[model samples]
Target: MIPFDLHTHCTLSFDGKSSAEDMVRRAAELGVKHYALTDHVDLGDHADPDFDLEATVSGAKKLLPALREKYADSIDLLYGVELGQFVHAPELAKKLLSENDYDFVIGSTHNIRGYDDFYFLDYKEYDPFRLLGTYFDELLESAETADFDVMGHITYPLRYITGDFGINVDLSQYAPIIDEILRALIKRGRGIEINTSGLRQKFGRIFPDEWIVKRYRELGGLILTIGSDAHCTDDLGKGIDEGIAVAKAAGFDRIAIFKYRKPTFIRI
Candidate 1:
């Protein structure tokens, strides 16, 4: 059984379909002992300019207790938010994180230079090597600025670039940059996730790539988490077993789960 799924979305996020109740029920069915509802909190250029950050945190706090009680005996639920890096909104990101008591926070670079480049950017024009290098740089900057508990989807852009485009972006070529990012994350006490969502997408490879995972372990980065990044009920726990195998292959003997902001390690 999967130890915990720290990255998932319910109705709390913009694109999610399941409610917390449904998610809890599904997790119970899968024998998942711990889970986190990490909804997206976009800090990009186009997010509702007047969005109430305080209210968002308040709402999440208010809902956690009820959800926890409802699923008390079955599974543990963690309150989390996925914060995207806008680069320009560093202060806003810091403020939101400072004011909230999230059990876990995922720092993601969904935007570059205030633009939503995660999905909108075309991968064909530039050299794949250069593009990936730039992406890792941005990720490093985001991690340094936000100082979050975990780095979300370390190789996110690959989800859209590899298969149909037939671009052979070898992750090993960027090992030095990858090492820097992993080292920075380790220095900041941040964990990297095995985001299994890529398995269901065109990328066909897990985040951070296998080589990055191996290097991370070698660099003394032991804090690891597994997640589905599921937007719907059916996607929950998808490829989690494969994720565990990947982590074990990378030399991790345990995976982490969080509760009330405290990490509990589970043997793989």
Candidate 2:
């Protein structure tokens, strides 16, 4: 498998620490064959007050061309976005997708309607089960209607709920809904990303977990991508080898890379 990481963040993201050039350079140095700068473009009322979509999109557009050329010998740098909350503002999402020639767009739901990001929520104060139910419902909606190449971190809420709070979630309860989400993605020719960020965090497993990956494969979902979800330079391509192992274990002979909004599979 080529060392690649399709999901990552840079200074353009509200929570990112490294700059785009820095992250891309680091990926090149690490021998990453394919690297994507998928910074956060989280939208809707639940989005951070400080996030500026126009600036983020324009800044990336300006910075990427030079960086891509500079690292062209070492890396294939892709300009991508982790677009969160597509269901919240469908028209705005459409507008953003139409305007920017994003090489990849990851449809994600950081929070449900009328709530903060799962990272900020006090799990003790809310019903985790209810939140997960809503989260999966929103994921299904994103799968059905969002303009994206892949669904980012399908079990995102668990990163905080179970990883931080040590709460054990009964994933079986959500299986039916998850199947619906997977089916929706497969039907639309969309994909899911196996986010490796959890491996370095309190969570010791990948996002969506192994069973989910296997299930997606079994359900005839062909598109799968792996990512570190790195927010800093040191974390670039982190755990990506392990992510490939997970993909292989899940029975995927090939993984995907996107450019011009079309998937090109790379054999693992």
Candidate 3:
């Protein structure tokens, strides 16, 4: 049984299709006892200038408590936000995080400086190595300063490189850069996530794959969270069993669940 899924998105996110209620119900059905609804929060350059967080935050306030109480007997629910590019908008990011009582936060950089998310861009147009180099650089910068329990999808841009474009990315070229990011998170007592969404995507492989997980373990990085990154009900808890196997093979006997931004390890 998949005990927990720490990263998820519901309709509160701009691109998500499932409701928190539906996601929660599906989790209970799948024997996932602990679940977190971490909708997206992209401030500043990550979002348009006029994009508002108020509506998203307000929706969360009304939905989370109701779902938590309704599922209290069957599931342990936590409210979370996946905040992007905090390094690009520290003041605004901190303000939004401060104004709400989020149980967990995921720091990510979906975009480079002036570009949109790699998902929206045409990967064929850019030099694969240079593009991923920039992507890793931004991730390193975010890791240096974003306030969050874990970094979401440590190798996200790879989705575009290896998945969408069907290009084989030489991860070796960026190992030193990735190590820098892992070390920064370790220094701050933060963690990284095993995002299971990759299984359903064209990549057909886990993000960062098993080797990265092994490297993180070798580096003394202890905190890890597993997630489906599900935007719909059918995908809920998907690949998490493999996620657990990955963690075990990487030397982790347990994974984490966050409450009030603090991690509590759960034995697998």
Please give the CA lDDT of all the candidate structures: 0.78, 0.90, 0.86
TM-score of 1: 0.91
Error of 2 at 70 (Å): 2.6
lDDT of 3: 0.86
Question: Superposing every Cα of model 2 onto the true structure, what RMSD results?
Answer: 1.1
TM-score quality measure for candidate 2: 0.98
| Quality of model 2 by C-alpha lDDT | 0.90
Predicted structure with the largest lDDT when compared to the true one = 2
**In candidate 3, residue 58 scores what lDDT?**
83
Number of clashing residue pairs, candidate 2:
0
lDDT of 2 at 106: 90
- The regions of model 1 sitting more than 4 angstroms off are 46-58, 125-129
By summed lDDT, the worst window of 10 consecutive residues in model 3 runs over 43-52
Global fold similarity of model 3 (TM-score):
0.96
User: TM-scores across all candidates?
Assistant: 0.91, 0.98, 0.96
lDDT tens digits by residue: candidate 2, 164-245 = 9999998999999999999999999999999999999998899989899999999999999999999999898888888889
Q: Tell me the number of clashing residue pairs for each predicted model.
A: 0, 0, 0
Cα lDDT tens digits, model 1, 1-268, are: 6678889987766677988678878988888788888887877675645455555566777786678788888888788887777355887877777777888888877656644455665666655566677778888786566657778888887776675566667777777777888898888777888899988888787886877777889999988888999998899889889999999999999998766556679998
lDDT of 1 at 254: 94
